[model samples]
Target: MVVGARLEGIQLSGIRKMFELTTERSVNLGLGEPDFQPAQHIRQALSDAVEKGYNKYGPTSGISNLREALANGARKYRSDITANDIVVTTGSTQALMITAQYLFNPGDDVLLPDPGFVLNVPQVRIAGARPLMYPLKQEHEFIPQVDDLEKLVTPKTVAIYTNSPSNPTGGVMSIEDIRAITQFAEDHDLWIVSDEVYDQIVYDREHQSFLGDYDKVIHINSLSKTYAMTGWRFGFLITKAPIIDKLSILNYYTIACPNVPTQHAALAAMTGPQEHVKQMVNEFKRRRDLIVDRLNRIDGIHCLVPKGAFYAFPKYDFNISALDFAMECARSDLICTHGSAFGDAGEGHIRFSYANSMDNINKGIDIFEEVCEKIKG
Candidate 1:
């Protein structure tokens, strides 16, 4: 009855714990899942696939149509990618895990942004590798500073994990920053694992994929956030076919293949009319503005107005731990993720998702303000 040493450092996600408190009465600010269901056309696509007996195992690299569609989508951002470079995955989570497993050896150091997606550190750890944290400074609007990342590099460093329109913070990296990071990766001969799941959700800026001029970047994307298809478990990875060959072998042993009908659903998600996506982004932007404004009106609280994504990471001057604050909020029928759940770098903050309706968001803020007052006294 021996557990693997590779999993010793990993724990269940803190966001999951906060999610358990959700009820009809609770204002759920935790978890980044979109409140909307997949558009009717996407569901129709899934139904059509199932009716056509598309439920069998798909190729490990995914169906050819879906792969081609994904490549076309990538070309809108980076012109050189092709279907051969794409490997449809079960989800961005699995794609990231497979990439980590393929790119890192035991005891290798992978640089990760502190206060990153909660799974980022654990994914590296599960690969029998160490995660070195680079600061995403509050002073820098939560963007990773090149100097800070450079200072953390060591002989064991093998890769850098980057997320734009970042989770919890909603900070999108600029073109110049992307170029600097890409140049740094080139200079060091390190691989870049780029998480661009929120590529379509940015408000003020365009997404600049690290793969723009860099062949060293491995791009991870998902239909979950873009098409509101989280439960469908569909995503894909982009890298050279040589790396895709290795990841396909890993996939054969892991998921065997992504769900067949869901891949068809994802194909529809990719090639279908993109107006639904644009509408979703507009709604999210409105909610983001609403939540940031409401949080800023609270005394001692300052929320950095996010440039992209639907989550806001708000800093507070309260003299309490983030976990304690979150627990108290949960007791008051509010569920928000604690900042420390992200990392030590996030200790004094809390993450709020604006994925819910504007009415619910306002209600949640009212509850949050009341809780703040109660705690202050």
Candidate 2:
């Protein structure tokens, strides 16, 4: 059997490729994963759910209790959203895929951020659309400028995909930036897909949502980062009833429903004591500060202080290409993502995730500093 021609232009994520190439002895600083495990209460909830026989297929929209709990939690920030507006999916990745499939037709162009998540471009292509990139310059704290977005929009542009507390860079969009983007979407009648998986992990500022000002925004979130439940494969979307209806059908065809036991655990994560979240955020903040400070102190590597999330995107003074630099690091047993994996504009940088222990982070830096000396221009 022949593969589909649509996949001819797409390639494997460079991040995952690098990850696979690393040996067991490698000190990983690549993937944006939380080092913490799932909270005890959440794990116990899943265990209890399994013992109580909640293993059957659930409603495609989600189990009702979890949906209501999610709605209530979300309403604390976005008051207009209701239980009817949320649909649980396999993960935020799938939530994004559903949004793209629902909104984009073949050849439709969707604006995404440069120096964004590695998966964003491929996901857009899988939906049969062209991906247009808007710059998220380091000088601008990695926030997308409205003027750049406007320049990229054409009649074929159908949507804008945004990630706050962005992956590959821990840059959180400012409230002013959010307002400008929401207004732009309004003026152009374009759908807005907001990836907010890291909403709970912001360091020094409040997490702003496009949902606060517009119903046209589709908000996607998950328990992965916040609760350290990456393997759980649970995520969801918040939108109005009509969109929810369309997503429900799409979800049915795709996942049938999110895993039942995990959904119960996700409900516990949403409605249980939130102090666990605060604790995790605090730990991540500590790691973020430690890593960023260490990186900035290196002679040729300068990292911007990330306002949220747990990554440090540092620009380097090295003359080598990002790919060669990353591979060189790997040879030294220091694993990291090359910035160019995210987009063309990411050529001169590398993304380091502080999701490991403080001890590992410190150890990694010692090796990183040594590698920098070798690669110094």
Candidate 3:
């Protein structure tokens, strides 16, 4: 066969599948990217860097100042986080990919959240490993249960992935849940890969991270969601210092090095005016409120209020499967991701990203209601 067997069954992400189907008139909400542009200062910094002839291959571990800035930012989670602990990657996604490739071996099992980020499953498989799952139940507000995790663990299990201010569900882990996960990882002697991309996007309470002084904790984060820097593709990983050196070698071979201009831009984002982030969070909270209220207004839907991130995963009483419902919405010019796209536990639910505007979300919800009415009839 022309294609490699390992990549044979892996399909394009369900979110992207819906996203590619959308037209300008589609009232799209399929993707999770921020609607806002990167902050002005950040943009200017990029332009300045490019104009100043800074476009070159940066250090494989990234520009030292940028790494230092990220390390400083991470200090909030663990006071000891420093430049020595960071390996800047193309994005948080790459950090995750490197982690998977660097650690997982065939026959090893990595426990993932069943309704977790799509990357969590594919990355491990791509590394020639199996992904075991623990359900993130709606009843538990989408938090993983330690008992459930323990049930999935065996001699083969190597690591676990956790996301806070989660993507599809927007479930920010409660402090109790955070403690439970941390303790569980400690007990099992498993590596805790924490994805904190939405760390600064919380609504209700503070985002408590899994990045505390544990050496086994591999913390992955980026400016994509936080500063609307997805296009910049700047992110970093914090782990044991030795592991940072190891991942940096893989990072060098994978991308050679992160682009220089963007590293400067990311540094500006890190050090620039704080008001933009605060303002953005406030706006997201308002959007979240609007989307939840409108989603709950639909006759057969019940939306769980998201305390963080920009997506709403709403459960529906419709007889149709989540994929069919989402496709029906898309056919009707409304873009959404099927709940099952998240995982099996997400069935009967649908993910709507409100990262667009209030006007677009209103239009999408109207299309959703129209679809519901036709199906119910």
CA lDDT scores, all candidates in order: 0.89, 0.88, 0.88
Estimate the Cα RMSD of every predicted model relative to the unseen true structure.
1.2, 1.4, 1.3
Residue-level lDDT of model 3, residues 1-377, one tens digit each, is: 46688896898888888888788679988878989998889999999999999977768899888889988888888898889899888889999999999989999999988798999999999998999988877778888889999889998888999998897889888777878888888888889998989999998688998887567889899988889989888888998636778899999989999878999999998988989988889988888899899989889899889888888999889899998998999899999999899889889999998888889888888898899999998
Compute each candidate's TM-score over C-alphas.
Answer: 0.98, 0.97, 0.98
Off by over 4 Å in 3: 1-3
Per-residue accuracy of model 1 over 174-217 as CA lDDT, tens digit each = 99889889888888889999999999999967887877777878
Which tens-of-lDDT digit does each residue in 1-377 have in candidate 2? 35787777788889998898778888899977888889899999999999999999999989999999989878867887788899999889899889888988898999999988877888889888999999888899899888999889999898898999898788898888899998998889888889999999998778987778677889999889999999999999998626789999999999888899999998888888989889888888888889988999999888998888888889999899999998988998889989999999898999898888899889889998998998874
* Clashing residue pairs, backbone N/CA/C < 3 A, model 1: none
Residue 332 lDDT in model 2? 88
- Candidate with top lDDT is 1
Q: Which consecutive 10 residues in model 2 have the weakest lDDT in total?
A: 1-10
Over 4 Å off in model 1, which ranges? none
